[model samples]
Target: MTAATAPTGLGEAHTVYLDHLADADEYAATDLAIGLLDAGVPAERVLLDLVAPAQAEVGERWARNEWSVAQEHAATHISEQVVAAVSAHARPDPTNGRVVVACMDGEWHALPPRLVAEVLRLRGWQVTFLGASVPAAHLVSYLHRYDADAVALACALPMRLPYAHQMIEACRRSDVPVVVGGRGFGADGRWARRLGVAWAPDAPSAAELIADERALRRVPPGQLAHLADDEYASLVRRRSELIDGALAELRERVPAARAYTAAQLDATVSDLGHIVDFLAAAVYVDDASMFTEFVQWLVEILGSRGVPVGAIALPLEHFGAVLRDFPRAARALALGRAALPGVAR
Candidate 1:
């Protein structure tokens, strides 16, 4: 279906515009962004109020089974195009100083940081938008060479938090203040605080925090101190081992899985790997809730796709067996087991 240039008046056609996005029409989305500017709507408002909401709705659609992964990706691609159109129209004033925006390594979720980067640019910061999955070493070198006023990191998945922590620490060594954001930080940014860096709840707030003199100048804290009993490190080291054993056991116990097609089997293995990675991150950060929340979310996603939650839950029991001596992993596994539907404790 064709969508006209979005209502030039501020926010009048939000729902209609979102419908166009759901249809995977990039032209409709881009026309809306450009028309908003033509109507004298501020660039950032077009981005934050219009594009951002539609982008979020795309994710919600995928989460609810209304849209497949491909549809979600296509919608997001349209949103990115819209953001670019708006960004190109808004010239940077550079009065707010320099900032670096990057998505965490192993994190393919680039849209969040892309939004932040555009927001910073609109607010007159000399923002170097580093795109997605920038390696820690490259990021550190960039900070050292250009000497940014602050670094804003985006992480969407919980599994990326461990590597994000590494990036945060690397920035600290270069004396660049780091501001962490996105779902990976949780609702309150409790993990960001624990990792000993600043947190921004969203793009607008990230701009505000960087503009505020007091929050801007504070030096990033030194590396988070290590725990006395760091079972986390050991768990991380044996991650492949855990996934290998868990998959073998899952195939043995689940008769349906044994008869599955190659694609189905690959998806199952990938899901298990994600579980192991998330649990490792949880243990690395010494936080039980992250793993628990991830497990709950995974089960819900699986159930939505008509996959039995039991398939996901079974790994928890298996993980618990192998990681019996590891306190954090063991706790997370138990939480997963308890939260899974129809699973007996």
Candidate 2:
């Protein structure tokens, strides 16, 4: 079939974009991104609609041993180029509020922060793109220099957790309200709230957040509520059906396999809950990174730990099940539990 004859929708188009991303077809991905941008797909939605899904697919392929690290790196490079191009055109309204979008020091993944900036800019808020790996001192200076209305940080790795928190604290010390997004902001989200800053799990929700009254006023105790309500509320509300049921079934299969501690299981459950939260944020706000990151992390971490993702109830399993009902996770988990004697409970 000719490319022009191919079907189109968020789903079909998304698959093509992902294939190009995984293949590191930089020219193709860039053109797809440009076409998406020309289609009036808001830059934020493009990230949510195109880039994030593309990243997720690349990640999934890597997890399944389908794509190599070089392939993943190539895909990321292509995505960065395209997303950065779109971000370059993000012009904010002159009289609107201002937001500073940055990546914390050592967090070079600029896609999420860039995505947030685009959405806010599309919403008529002035955005200053600080690019990637920004130092805290420089960000503070920029906040004062620009008299920024809000600060947004995008993080894409767990390795930069400490730096991300430090930057948020620094912003708060400067009396600058901040909003944080990215897939890696998982366990550290509460820290952002505790520092009296705003948090958006994704770009689109970050736009809605900038629109909220809370984004304008002093940060409140409930400011985090919007991060949950608008960003991740849906996934949190409905994840029990997937995670809880899966865990319960696993425990039933191997009653003696409960070598893993309750504390650990509880944390896993909590992480799954947060995954739901992130998914909700992505769904409602048009930010796919959260969902992508969650699944990606699960796959990578499990693989590193010699755990098969099919042994877990992660969303990938949910997605895989939808695609093939393969029970990849259940089988993997069962095998992993059998091999790792201490990880069962």
Q: Which candidate is the best by TM-score?
A: 1
Assess every candidate by TM-score: 0.93, 0.60
Which portions of model 2 show Cα errors greater than 4 Å?
1-3, 37-44, 87-95, 213-345
Q: In candidate 2, what are the lDDT values of residues 280-345, reduced to their tens digit? A: 434432334444555555656567656655455433344334323223223332332333323433
* Per-candidate RMSD, Å: 2.3, 12.6
Residue 33 displacement in candidate 2 (angstroms)? 3.1
Candidate 2 clashing pairs, residues 3+ apart or interchain: 231-281, 258-345, 259-345, 260-345, 310-328, 310-329, 311-329, 311-333
TM-score of 1: 0.93
Q: What are the Cα lDDT values of the candidates?
A: 0.83, 0.63
> What value does the lDDT take at residue 185 in candidate 2?
56
Best by lDDT: 1
Q: What lDDT is obtained when candidate 2 is compared to the true structure?
A: 0.63
Q: What is the lDDT of residue 115 in candidate 2?
A: 64
Q: Taking the tens digit of each residue's C-alpha lDDT, what string does model 1 give over 230-285?
A: 78778778888888898889889987778989998889889988998899878767
